[model samples]
Target: MDSLFLVLPLLLSASFPHFTSAHNTAPPPCHFQAIFNFGDSNSDTGGLSAAFGQAAPPNGETFFHRPVGRYCDGRLVVDFIAKSLGLPYLSAFLDALGSNFSHGANFATAGSTIRPQNTTLHQSGFSPISLNVQWYEFNDFQRRSKIIRERGGVFRDLLPKEDAFSRGLYTFDIGQNDLTSGYFLNMTPGEVKAYIPDVISQFIAVIKDLYNHGARSFWIHNTGPAGCLPYVLTKVPVTAGQIDKYGCASPFNEVARHFNVKLKSAVAKLRRSLPKAALTYVDIYSIKLNLFQNATRHGFEHPLRACCGHGGKYNWNKDHGCGSTVTVKGRQVVVGKSCKDPSKAVVWDGVHFTEAANKFIFDRIVNGDYSDPPVPLRFACYRH
Candidate 1:
């Protein structure tokens, strides 16, 4: 009778298997453990003005009540990226006011650039931290994190050799400012086109450097259709009555196409060179195209029009830009006006996007809809 009981217990154990293996077999949560963001105003979350206290209006008023240095009504692309990854909103590392480096931090500064000439946005003589400087900051973060771990006596276990390779995702969304600033500086579209290849080469080098620093996964965004931006359309002299079917300027779209071709090729070559790296190209160009093509579907009434502006001819206010305010009836009133629902508008300002627009882009990234192969590299890697 004792031998029979022992045999029965052994049979049940064999049938059930170990609890640890069962847990391991179950799919882990689909969340990005960490996020590292580097870019411009499109993703800057209070990095610039927070450091200098330079005031801007209508920015961050949508969600955060007061301005948060994100040159938009609400969240920027970086915020959406973190949200999609299930991580908290990435704070700006330099934002002494609201700086937090727990989950991740933003190293992007407004008016920064990929190339030296790209810093033309700060036409006022004083230059902000360029992309090169931002990279230096990233290096500093790594050093500081290592120091903290070592001093806390957890370095040996917390930062294992494999941790270097297991470092989190890195995202970069820049170059639009470079092109826009060039246009503002009186550089013709042809001249800007001639200079973009060198700019792309510099970008490639930056990515490679990050890879050398143990960054295995990368998300790079192609330049969006810049000519469609309100800033460009208002500034650059497009030919009268020459608009594409989507109401965008033809010459500008042509420039964007040219840049995308070179960038796509460069990314492909980089992938070949760095076989172990998972470099995924986010198709901002295509995503923007989709948004423009299906503007009504996205609920945008006027994709080409700036939401916060007042002017008769150009659909933008000449004297007052977005965030400018005026005194009205003994109370301060914001100069620009927003749509009843920002989600129904695409252009947040003369150059950026609305929070809803960012949400759409995030959806594309998370759902693996932005890549040419129609699957995000993160998911594809896990599946394999």
Candidate 2:
């Protein structure tokens, strides 16, 4: 943990060599009243957990001090975004218990994809709540919240104001699953590449739908380096030659890069069509890929290993995943346990990043170092 503080400065300096006091010195030019996030496990607060079951122990042990429906040991990148904007953590749209949608609601569920899979969660380990489904949830929430607020009383405080839809920031961190799902089904990288256009088209449709519903600011994150994730490394078959020096599967990363390129181009086209909207295409792939390639430099270790998994070369096993239990010699024991120090680890589970790592990525992107048009998160409402 001490190493984090020491190397964090270096990490920040390396991200933006022109880093100055002026960056943090400036105040936010505009205010985003709320944030409506849509994605998968990377930014999911509680949607999947609420519908299925809670993510087991050690999941939210870092910052929240208990399991709070986040995949990370503490908070996701979205949580940091809320804190930075002085807003409260977003409630999941599907979670009815102890929720406050006054600021905004998260429609992201773990294992979600841009294109809906035909298989069930038990069959494919993917969520039924696709990007389009999330858009529908948001559409419903937007309409019903206004109706309920008209009655006033306690309900008014629990839901967002009508104007919040237009003033809120719409964020997306999906598409990684769309690529991996194909791989899991034994499809070639070429096959996955073939469907990317359709996936991206669906994504654009949702953004346009949101725009029609009055969302003016969009903070869209292109998917991260799927090849660098332990989940992919363990699940997918790969030739040693396909693996890069960084211990990532080169072919998979190439596909991910291809997806990002298409997504960026789509976002650029969306900007011209939706003239009123401020669309920021954040290059999360580069940021995460760089972190994996230079893990030790950022005070992290085992870039390709899961901090909370049972056993394997990457400490990941599909059958006995993170939080899995087993009876060893007639005694029940938790096989998948967290590392001693999550701060020193980049990945938490095989699929998700630790809170420490999320914070690291968030800090860099908040300065617009990885975003298009070079606009900070504070001024994302402005179209460059």
Candidate 3:
């Protein structure tokens, strides 16, 4: 099901938080010249769409007014992060046409995971552009972009400065797909949990690789509550006992929690190994779960149901999802479309969050309230 090709826009902005150094002096905010992002749909600007095809219609209607690579109806969390830092939106590293990499590049593709999948995109709907592949692409871009810039002309203006690599902020929001993929393959939760250590080890290796490549600042997000997503609840079979009071699947959420714990531990280990690097482990799972737990208080309706899509308890159908075109009577008609307003709902499609929800989550996390070390995003360069 294409609906399974999910993306979560992990972004941070709003409400600047204050942080002081060991000397009791405030650490000045970091001047991040650029951002080098890697992950899945949560932070992907257009990697998968540019690789396969555009995300079709009504996908970007809320903000861009047309499909512009993002799976959400409007901006993603990464978009807010760029704007908050006074940088332009990151151009997808895979987007070759009319793309300018002056500010930064996003390597996240929809349905991507930490470990490489053994199935074709058409067969399993999982992106072949795994985390390691994205790292390779980043490594190559870092080298080639400089060489091209040296040639001067249009290339120089399009590519980022050489120093941008070291001064840039590296963000990550992946791992959910790894768990989901296991479930899709009929693996039990315990079975999926078994490989988490290996999944985390691979993730840690990539971070170390980036560190070796001069990446000094990182903002890594643990996967969110996958059980709360409409796609998982509707697509995956779960018993009543598995459902939590918040209407989320407890088994899936528990697995996600386990992943977050391991990821946090890995980040702590990275801090010890890559002592020079500034790593911020953001607790996005708690932030998102709170939103669902207090949907009305957060001004959201149907936190578990998708704003777009057709026919089902959650308004999600794997076959006829948001923007799905169906041939009614020799003529194809778009039955899956946007609702009256997407802002009021939390989930946009069956997987992604609406722009409003993205902003809501962004506003809270940017202040460092949900981040380890409680450091604001602007000052994420500091290890403290």
**TM-score of each model, in listed order:** 0.82, 0.93, 0.94
Count of clashing pairs, candidate 2: 0
Error of 1 at 155 (Å): 13
Task: Give one digit per residue, the lDDT tens place, for model 2 in 194-250.
Answer: 999999999999999999999999999999999999999988999999999989999
Ordering by lDDT: 2, 3, 1
Candidate 1 vs candidate 2, TM-score winner:
2
* Candidate no. 2 TM-score: 0.93
Per-candidate clashes, comma-separated: 2, 0, 3
* Clashes in predicted model 3: 3
Model 2 scores a C-alpha lDDT of 0.90
Q: Candidate 2: which stretches are off by over 4 Å?
A: 1-28
How much is the lDDT of residue 238 in candidate 3?
98
**Residue 105 in candidate 2, Cα distance off native in Å:** 0.5
Candidate 3 global CA lDDT score = 0.89
Candidate 1 local lDDT, 1-384, one digit each (tens): 244334533332342234115433423333455677788777888777766665376666677767777878888777877776667787787874545465666888776678765233335322367677778888887777766666555443332232432457788888776676666778778987998898789888888888788777777778888777777788777776657877788777777788888888998898779866766777888888779779898777788888766654435654667767778899988767665777777888767888888877776665445763344434322221
Candidate 3 — worst ten consecutive residues by lDDT sum? 4-13
Off by over 4 Å in 3: 1-24
